[model samples]
Target: MTERFYDQLSKDFEEMVSWRRYLHQNPELSFQESNTAKFIADKLRSFGINVKEQVGGNGVIGVIEGNHPGKTIAFRADFDALPIHDEKNVKYKSSVDGVMHACGHDGHTSALLAVAKVLNNHRNQLKGKVVLLFQHAEEKPPGGAKFMIEEGALDGVDFIFGGHLATDLPVGKIATRPGPVMASVDAFKITLQGIGGHGARPHQTIDTVAIGSRLVTHLQEIVSRRVDPVEPAVVTVGSFHAGNAFNIIADSAILEGTVRAMNSNVRQQIESEIRAILDGMKVADRIEYSLEYIHGYPVLVNHKEEALLIEKLVKETISLDAFVEKDIVLGAEDFAYYLEERPGAYFHVGAHNEQAETQFPHHHPRFDFDEKALLQLSRIFLQLANHYLVTD
Candidate 1:
């Protein structure tokens, strides 16, 4: 049965590419996926799946039931594109200005659509039901996953599954592990206010740029010297803005960055250390400073049992050799929100093909993936839904 399904998926692979390319050409930003949502909803409806739109802000849900009653499982795909301009000169490059599907959300969305089409064709042979979640705003904070959960996307779900397209991994491969697949994602901002004066003066000005530069280095020490050596943590200041004139000592400097930690304890410690650093700066420099730390997403821990189930499915679909055990990544995902409520595991599906030059990192304007990877994900979704829902 699986073999036949794979063959059928192969037959429809080009159509799936067309769907993905259309989405890529018309990418939408986070929380603004109105057209993207409509496209997905329309596709699911055409497949005869019961469609539910406006799920947690532009999220779309497709419910397909088997001939008989059984358990219910879900598969999620985030459809929001990043705020990057399309850099690729391909035939289907993004038409939207300053927005493109650089993170393979297009692939994920299309693959889920393909899964819906294939499963709907085999609905009579299915044992239970599958819920398809087309999520929005994955690239932004307060992710669509939380909104979907709030709107009851997991109300009666038994087992849920999700996966990402990894351009670093070669096509025909998948990676998963049992615990701590991704780190906790957080954001922090430190605004340093000081006295402004002539840059030429030695002691008349506070020199906020100097203070901010020192602060950036001091911030990293928390991750390196304070956090556990064995634990994975990152504190990076990706943005810094200070003054209008190079000759004037800027009175205010703003530092914004992200924090990644492997666990809650590590995350807490980093936060505490950062506050301590901010306090020290306030006292020593005698400057007014404020800290805004927002916790974004939790560590993505894969339930051991669910991880094992995914491993089994991967081994069955491809070979054991294609099922690689990957190390924990510092990258965080909002899918952690869904796992908090139900048993689920997120896997990395390889989409890189060196021969085809689909090897750029995600969020890069030049980012793309081998379309065949979409079919692989579709098969995984189809198999997982059947096995998870069908009772013995």
Candidate 2:
């Protein structure tokens, strides 16, 4: 193989940019990706690949079976956008109000589409099957990955590959590592019920704001003293809502937050401690409260063989400098759901462009990525397929 496997596909690369801009212009939010699904299915059909729509709540699957028989591997791209509004000044800025592809899912979708085109042209040169997963609702809880798996997305699949585009890293690099690269998250919501009264009647009222404030302060101890020092854990209280008027005391208060941990045992332990702390809470005035914990994505652990394969291929196809060892991140991803069942590895494609000042982090309104990074992504996918599909 040549240095760049896709150097011959320059026109397609340009078209990929067009596709990225179009998807960036009109992004759809989690789980409601009808237009996005239709667009992907139509594109896959145009390339003569087999398409299956609505496999799992707007997820579309494309199948490319080679002439010979080999392992069945899956490559996935999440097409769901975030709830934030776009704030960039580019001409192809998001037209949809209050919804944007701030996390570079548009770029991921574009790269995967271009990859399908390249693989189709060279279908006679390979063995085995390639399953293209166009997943939805990755940004929201009850991730679409779980739904797609339930709907048979991974049926007969041997291995899987997925990646996120990181805007903090420059466009030329790729990031990968083995074992728990990202954290597992558990989100909690607490509602405190108390008696409301006028500001003048302080003695007659139970102030929920006071109770919630104390609870939030005390919850921090779960991470500091309860969890082991060697284990990484975090409890962040993101939102607290209570009274509205200046003089009227609110009868109830709501607190919402998230807990993150890298290890499963620590995850369960931290959660148990949280429950115990709230159960042991004492107040001068009797108050009632309710707690709800929602299990989210598990820790993203890369398979040893898959990660080593990608790292080796990246050095050969790209440059040795392009391969980076990433530290454990507290952020969560639904891709972890796929890894929970199969042997797969998740990597990151760098999208940071210093000259363009597109360095803002993901999920921010001003978040942007280097579109050229998609070409690197396309090449990586093609190389992986070439190696995995070889029957000899």
Candidate 3:
């Protein structure tokens, strides 16, 4: 039965790829995916699926009900693109200036659309319900997943599944693990205020630049010496700004950076250390410092049972050799928000094209993926939905 459905998907693969290319050409950013939302809604509605528009500021949900009663399963796909220029010279390169789907979100969106179409046609064979989530603004801060959740995207969802396109993995392979698949991404900003004076008079002013430099070095030690070596943690001081003129001492210094950790214990440890460093500096330098920490997204931890089920399904549908139990990724994903609210797993589907130099890592101006993976992704979504609906 699964093979027959996949065969049907194969027949529609070309059309699916065409749709993906069209989306790639006209990309939109984060929460501002108005046209993209409309396109997705229109496609879902055309399949006779119940469509809900603007659920969470440009997010669209398509619900497909089956003939029999069973558990509800959801398949999610992010719809927002990045702010990048398409340098890849392809026939259907990004037409939108300063915006491109370099992260393969276009392919993700197309795969979900194809799954919706296939499931819509096989609605009678399905046992329960399939919720198709087309999320927006995954690239920006605060995340579209949080917005969708605020609007009740997972109100009654049983099991949710999502996948990212990975250039590191070879084509025809899938990689995933049971726990802590991705890290929690948080950003910090610190402003140190000190007395400004002439550079020649060193004792008259509190040197904020000197204090800021010390803080950056101290922050790096939080990961290396404070946090456990087994647990992955990173503190990157990406930006620093101070001083106006070479001869004048600046009144204030600004420091900005990001923190990534796999577990909450390590994350909180780093946060506490940062506060200690800032607090101590206030007393030592007689300077007032303000630290702002903006928590982005939580760590993506997959449920072991759900992950095992997905692994079994993939081994059955595709070659067992194609699945790999990979390690945790240092990168973060907004899909973590959904996994926190429900039992789910997020995996990676290979989209690499070895022959083309355009097959670079995501967020690159020339990054592109093979369109052939769309059909495989579509098959996986369809199989996951059907398998979960019937089994659960």
Better of 1 and 3 by lDDT: 1
Per residue, candidate 1 scores C-alpha lDDT tens digits across 119-146 of: 8887887777889999999989889999
| The 10-residue segment with the lowest total lDDT in model 2 | 1-10
Best model per TM-score? 3
TM-score of 1: 0.96
lDDT of 3 by residue, 148-191 (tens): 99999898889899988787777888888899989999999999
Arrange candidates, best TM-score first: 3, 1, 2
The reply for model 2, stretches above 4 Å from the true place, is: 1-4, 282-285
Displacement of residue 186 (Cα, Å) in model 1 is 1.1
lDDT of each: 0.89, 0.88, 0.88
lDDT of 2 at 205: 86
Which of 1 and 2 is ahead in lDDT? Answer: 1
lDDT of 3 at 75: 92
- Judge candidate 2 at residue 3 and give its lDDT: 34
Best by lDDT: 1
Per candidate, the number of residue pairs that clash is: 0, 0, 1
